[model samples]
Target: MDEIVTFGGRVTLGQDRQADDTERFLEMVGDRVRAARNRRSISRKTLSEISGVSQRYLAQLESGTGNISILLLRRVAEALDHKIEWLVGEEDPYTSDAVAMMSLYRQATGEQRMRVLEILDPDNPHLRRSRRLAFIGLRGAGKSTIGRLAADRLKLPFLELNEEIEQASGMPVNEVIALYGQEGYRRLEKQSVERIAATYDSIVLAVAGGIVSEPETFNYLLRHYHTIWLKARPEEHMGRVRAQGDERPMAGNPAAMDELRNILMSREALYARAEAQIDTSGRGLPETLDAVLDLIEKRGFLRA
Candidate 1:
C-alpha cells in the first residue's frame, strides 16, 4: 500500500497519524518477526507461501511499514511454527513472548515436544500449593541453599532428599548406586518420594538430579508437588558441585564434561516436565530467589 504504518487509537486510520502509529507498531512487529524467523532458520519465502501474506508485504511487515490483520499474522506465526500469542510480545510471564516463540519453534522441530507439553499443559486436580513439591536439577543448582531459603521465606519446612537417602541407606549416593545398582537406589528414591507425597504439607522439595531416571517416580511426584527445574549451563553445574567440596562427581568419570552435557540432554525431556523452570544461568542467589518468589506469586498461591 506504500503507506506508512502507524498505531491509531481509532479502529481505522486517519490518513497521516494512523500511518505513523501503524508504521511504528509495524516496525516493531517486523523486527520481532524477522528475529524469530531467523532463530528458527525459516526463510522469508516459505513463510510467504504458507501464510499467503505475500513476500512484498511480508518484507514491508518486517520493515515496520506493512500492517496486516491478526488473521494473517496467525497464519504467518503458524507457518513459522509459532502461536498467535507469540506475535503479541507478552504472556503471563510463565510463558514470555520470546520463550514462547523459542519453545514453539523447538517443539515443532525438536524431539522434546511430548515432555514439554506435559509441563506446559499439565493435568492437575488442584491449582493450590502442592504437598510434595520437588526441585530436580544438577548439583550446585542451589537446591539446598535455595530450597532452605525458599522454605525460610515461605516459613515452610524443607527436606533434602539426598540427606534422607544417605540416612536411609547409610551410604553416599555413588556407593548406594554401586552397591545396590541404579534400580535398587531408585526403589529407595521411589519410597522416599511416595512417603513424602503421602505425608507432609506446604513443602519446597529438593529432588535428586538422577530422580528423572525413574519416570514413574518422577511422574508420581508431579501428580502431587509443584516441581521446579533449576536450570543452568553445564559449566555452572560443575562449578557449583565443586565449590561444595563434592569432587566425587568428577571422579572416575574421565569424560565428566561430555557425560554431564549428555546426561543433561538425555534427562532434559524429563526435567522439562516440572511445574516450572528457573534459569539460574548467570544469575545471582538473590536474583534466583526473586525469580522463584515471582513464579510462586504468579501461580496464585499465598506464601507459606
Candidate 2:
C-alpha cells in the first residue's frame, strides 16, 4: 500500500507500471550490491553490523523486498570503500583520466568524471611515438641541433636525455655527478632512458656524448631500435663547441684536443653498433638530412 513518488507523479506500487520499472531497477541495484559484498567475502550479518543497517533491513534489500534510501546507499558504499553509484549498479567513476583524449570528456562536468572512467575502463591505453637518437662524439658535436631536426622530420618527439635527467633532479648534470658521484648519474640516466623507451614509440633521443660509458643501455638500444651515430672530426667538434663557449671539455689538459681524438678512438667499437653513421664534417643541415634519409630508406625503415 506504500506510495512512491516518481518523476511523472505519485505512483502506487501495485497500480502503476512506472512504479514497477522503479521496483525492477531497485532490485537490480540490490542484487549488484549483494554480489559485490559476496565478492569481498562479506556475509550479510557482517555487512549489516559494519554498515549499521539492521540485518533484517539489509536482507530485505538483498532479497528485493525492501526500499533503500539515498542516505542508506551512501552509508553502505562508504563502509565498503566505494562510491554509491558503484553499489547501485552504476559505473565506477575513478577511471576518467584514461579517456582524456575525448573532446566531450575534457569539457564534461566534474560530476561526469567517474562516468568517463567507467566508459574507458574496458579499452587499451593510447600509444606514443618515441625513440632514442644518440649523438656520439667529443664535446661540441651537433647532437642537440641535428637530433631536434631529425625528430621534427620524422614527426616524432625529441628529448635531450641529459637535460631531462638534470631537470628531473633539479640540478646541473655535473653538479649531480659531483654530489651524488659518477655511478649515481649513470643510474639516473639509465632509468630515464628506460622509462622513456617504454612509454613512447617514435622519438629522437639525444643522449650525452658519453653514454657509451654504460654499455648495457647502449646494447639495449642497438637490439631494440635504429641507432644513429652523429660523428665529426675532432677539429670540427672543438671549433663548434669553442664557438659556443663550453670550455669544460678543454680545461685542465695540455693535450685536450688529442685527448678527445683518443676518446673517440676508444669508443669507436661502440659507435659502430649504430645502424647508420653520419660524418658531419663540412655537412650542413640539408646534406646531412639527405644522408640520414637515404640511410633510413636503405635500412628499410621507410619502404619505396
Candidate 3:
C-alpha cells in the first residue's frame, strides 16, 4: 500500500499513528491537570505563583493548547501536591485506599464529589488495627526520649519517623522539603510509615509533629498503630530545640513562642485523637520516662 499524504508532506501510516498518540497523551495530561487543580480549588494564578510558571502558560496547558517541558509540568504537579506520575496516568507503587480516594476526588466532578468527601471519614473505626505503638506530639514533647526509653525497657525496636523519612529519601528532612516542598515531603512520610508498618511486627515509632496536617497519612498511622500523644508546654519545646543547638526555632522571629503556642493550640484536637496521652510538662526526664512506661503497661499496648 502507498503511504498517505496526511499533511503537506507524505507520511507513513506509522508516523501518523505516532503523532495521534502524542496528541492524545498531551490531551490526557491537560485534562488531568485541570481536574487536579479543580479538586484542590486552586486557581491558575495560585498555581503559577507556587510553580513559578506564568499564568498564561498554565491556562494554555489546561486547555491542551500549550507544549510544556517535563520540568515545568513537575513544578505544577508539586505545587498541586500531586505526584507527576499520578497526573500523567502512571501506576503508583504505594497505592492505598487513601491514595485511591485522592485519585477519585481528582477525577470526579463537583457537588457529588464534595458530598462523597464529606461522608468519607479518614479516622473511621473500621480502619483501626493496632500493630505497633506510635508517639505523637509537638516538636519538644519528649517523643524521642520517652519513646526510646520505653521501647528499650520493653525490648522493642525504637524508630524516629523523621529519621526514617530522611533515610528513605536519602537526604535530610530540610533537603527533602527544599527539593520537593511540603507536599512532596508528606508523600514520602506516608510511604515511610507504610513501609515501617509492613516491615516491623512490633516497634516504637516516634512520628513527626506535623504528620497530623496530612489527614490520610495521619489516619493511616492511627489505624495501624497504638497512638499516644506526648504533651509538653511551648516553653519546654523551645528549650529543648535550643538545647539541641537548633536555634532556628527562635531565629528572626520575635513572636516565635506565640507561633509555637498557636501551632500547639491548632493541633491539640488532632493530637488528642491518640489512644492515650502522656503530659510531660514540668516533669524531669526520669519521671516522664516512667510515666510512658506505666502508660504502655496499663494500656496493654505491647500486645496490641
Question: lDDT of each structure?
Answer: 0.78, 0.73, 0.85
How many clashes in each structure?
11, 9, 0
Q: What is the TM-score of each candidate against the true structure?
A: 0.56, 0.54, 0.57
Can you write out model 2's per-residue Cα lDDT over 8-123, one digit (the tens) per residue?
A: 99968666777787788878777867877886798888888889998888888888878889998787777666667666644433344433345466687754744565465633
What's the candidate order when arranged by decreasing lDDT? 3, 1, 2
Candidate 1 structure quality by residue, lDDT tens digits, 1-304:
2344457534433566776876777776787789778977878898788788899989988988777888989888888777766666544223367675665765473235434545766654343234445688977788878888988988888998877888889999889999999888899988887777667756777888888888788778877788888999999999888988989889988899898899899989988988789999999999999998888778744322
In candidate 3, what are the lDDT values of residues 1-304, reduced to their tens digit?
3477666988688877887887878777888888888988988899899999999999889888778999999999999888888767654313456667776787878645545644775454422443488999999888888889888898989999999999898999999999999999999999999999898868899998999989999998888888999998899999998998899988999999999999999999999999899888899999989888888888767632
- TM-score winner, 1 or 3: 3
Clashing pairs in 3: none
- Residue runs of model 1 more than 4 Å from their true location after superposition: 1-124, 127-131, 170-172, 251-254, 301-304
Residue 8 of model 2 has an lDDT of 98
Give the Å shift of residue 54 in candidate 1. Answer: 56
Ranking by TM-score: 3, 1, 2
